[model samples]
Target: MPQRIRKLIGTVLLLLLVVVWALSAMALAQGRVTELGWFLQLVCYVLLGALWIIPGGLLIRWMERPDQKV
Candidate 1:
């Protein structure tokens, strides 16, 4: 597969993941927000915000890889 294709696919998947992740996190936190303190809520949001980077970075790295010689 070409690098361009890989990058394009990765971009699409990453965007979908971000949207889903945000919605999922919000849904999960909706009922519990009142029970959790502000500090914990901030921590949860912060961690959720940053957690996607691991897979995104990995996909980007994969996109950046050179095609192997046949």
Candidate 2:
């Protein structure tokens, strides 16, 4: 695939990923952490926030990978 096409697709995918991730996260946390202590809640939130980057990093690397010579 061409670089421009890959970038356009990557940008769209990233936006969709963010939207889905945020909504999924909120859904996962909603009313589920009410019983947890504040400190624990903070830790969970921090973990959740940072963990999404793993897959995103992989995707980005693939997206930016150089086109192979034919």
Candidate 3:
């Protein structure tokens, strides 16, 4: 894979993850925010955060491959 392509793919994946996380966080602000509810939402957020590592790691590894040349 080319370095430019790898960087583009990595950037797109990171952007996708950011969009997902932002949307998930924004879902909390519609109406009637609560303490316990927020806590649970935070737990869910953490879970999702952890789940992101797999793809994130893959993207990073792809971008970092020594064979890729820009």
Candidate 4:
């Protein structure tokens, strides 16, 4: 992938992760975990954390390079 596209994908993934985290927090706070939504919410939380780790790290590294323009 081109550098620009890769950066865009990474940024999007990171933002999605953040949104997922927020939704998960809201669901938990609203006591949705004990309901039928628990399974989906659990999966979402897991994926959210995972997505943020690898892609977010790569994006940060890419953005940090002196030669690259975001």
Residue 3, model 1, lDDT: 86
Q: What does the lDDT read for residue 19 in candidate 1?
A: 94
Q: What are the C-alpha RMSDs, in order, of all predicted structures?
A: 1.3, 1.2, 4.2, 6.9
TM-score of each prediction: 0.84, 0.86, 0.54, 0.44
Question: Order of all candidates by TM-score, from best down to worst?
Answer: 2, 1, 3, 4
Candidate 4 similarity to native, TM-score: 0.44
Pairwise TM-score winner, candidates 1 and 2? 2
Could you give me the TM-score of model 3 versus the true structure? 0.54
lDDT of 1 by residue, 1-70 (tens): 9888998998998899889988987886786765898999888888878898898899889989998777
Q: Please provide, for model 2 over 1-70, each residue's C-alpha lDDT reduced to its tens digit, 9 standing for 90 to 100.
A: 8776787888888888888888888877786775799998998788778888987887788789888778
Q: Which candidate is the best by TM-score?
A: 2
lDDT of 2 at 7: 78
Whole-model alpha-carbon lDDT for candidate 3: 0.72
Name the weakest run of 10 consecutive residues (lDDT summed) in model 1: 25-34
Model 4, 25: alpha-carbon shift in Å? 1.1
Better model by TM-score: candidate 1 vs candidate 4: 1
Per-residue lDDT, model 2, residue 23, is 84
The full ranking of all candidates by lDDT, starting with the best, is: 1, 2, 3, 4
Superior by lDDT: candidate 2 or candidate 3: 2
Query: Model 2: how far is 53 from its true place, Å?
Result: 0.7
